[model samples]
Target: MAGNSWILHRNSSVNFEKIGDSAHTMLIADASEPYEVFGSTTNWRDPELARNTGPQSFGNCFPGETFVLLADGRVIQVPLVENERWKLLRGREELRPDPLATQRPDTPWELGDRPYVPRPRQQSGNRNR
Candidate 1:
């Protein structure tokens, strides 16, 4: 073990696996624990979440989406809300839309219909960059 990742998901199940060594790489769900989840094949490891980010990445995982864990302690069901952050972390071409669609950093949007957020601004000083 090289302190890489002792925990990983395979076939929609959670288990501890040492690094560099391949052991099945699959949970092989039991009869009691069905392998159906996340609107697709049973994949326990959250591809949407970046490594080491933890459950905080998912919107519904905490304070919002209800996080559900399997009885056998294998799978985790999180009602995720698609956002730009998630898409970028997906590491795929299917980029996810921005979390804040209304507000764009490049072209700021007004609190109502303008293109700038309503906030108190400070006067500029005599400084050349």
Candidate 2:
């Protein structure tokens, strides 16, 4: 398989609507062929955004959980091991994660972690005054 692991949008499975902002994404794997993924997110949805920044790559999916698709195509959750690594390949080329970059926290969300807070924008003064 070209992809040792594949990403699936958890939200997509629940509903086909595109998450204009963000979606709950997850990484999944199988021992043999790449799961024949299907859905609006896979087909009708934006491809570039999907491939570049959205739910189509690595650890960005669900952060700390791994999943496996069964032969019947049902998805089941799995735990992500800190040292387990996967590779993505295109034809004869392969993309692998840097060994040094593989460290991750055991839990996806640390206790007491603060949620993101965007900084307020500053307004510019009228120079013509």
Candidate 3:
């Protein structure tokens, strides 16, 4: 739940996976006492539950933003809204419009809306004789 988090939504349920590891990650139903892990698919379509749980319950570790990898292999950085629910929302819903879209540092420049701007090349100290 710290650095570099990954999430998966399948069969009407959401789960979190650790980046760079093949281990099975459990979905904690309640992070409090009893510490129950979701054993089966959850009823994620319930709007009331989603609104009450908030975004953090949906694997958003960062306070301001969270990076999500879509099923189509596309990665998107979503800006978090305080106390907002994202459990029932699709990945595309969190995406900002073209003009406001932000490209993550790890994302390739070519995939972003902004045109690639390369740094100027430095001239060699030794000039051609």
**Best candidate per lDDT, number?**
3
Q: Candidate 1: list runs displaced more than 4 Å.
A: 1-41, 45-61, 64-82, 94-129
Which one wins by TM-score: 2 or 3?
A: 3
Q: Give the lDDT ranking, best first.
A: 3, 2, 1
Per-residue alpha-carbon lDDT of model 2 for 33-69, expressed as tens digits? 1112332222121111222122333222243444543
Model 3: residue 53 alpha-carbon error in angstroms: 5.4
10-32 in candidate 3: lDDT tens per residue? 32222232222222121222211
RMSD of each: 18.0, 19.2, 20.5
Over the full model, what C-alpha lDDT does candidate 2 score relative to the true structure?
0.28
How many residue pairs clash (N, CA or C atoms closer than 3 angstroms) in each of the candidate models, in the order given? 4, 0, 0
In model 1, how many backbone clashes occur? 4
Please identify model 2 stretches exceeding 4 Å from their true place.
1-55, 58-61, 82-129
What's the best-to-worst order under TM-score?
Answer: 3, 2, 1
Candidate 3, which segments miss by more than 4 Å at Cα?
A: 1-40, 43-59, 81-129
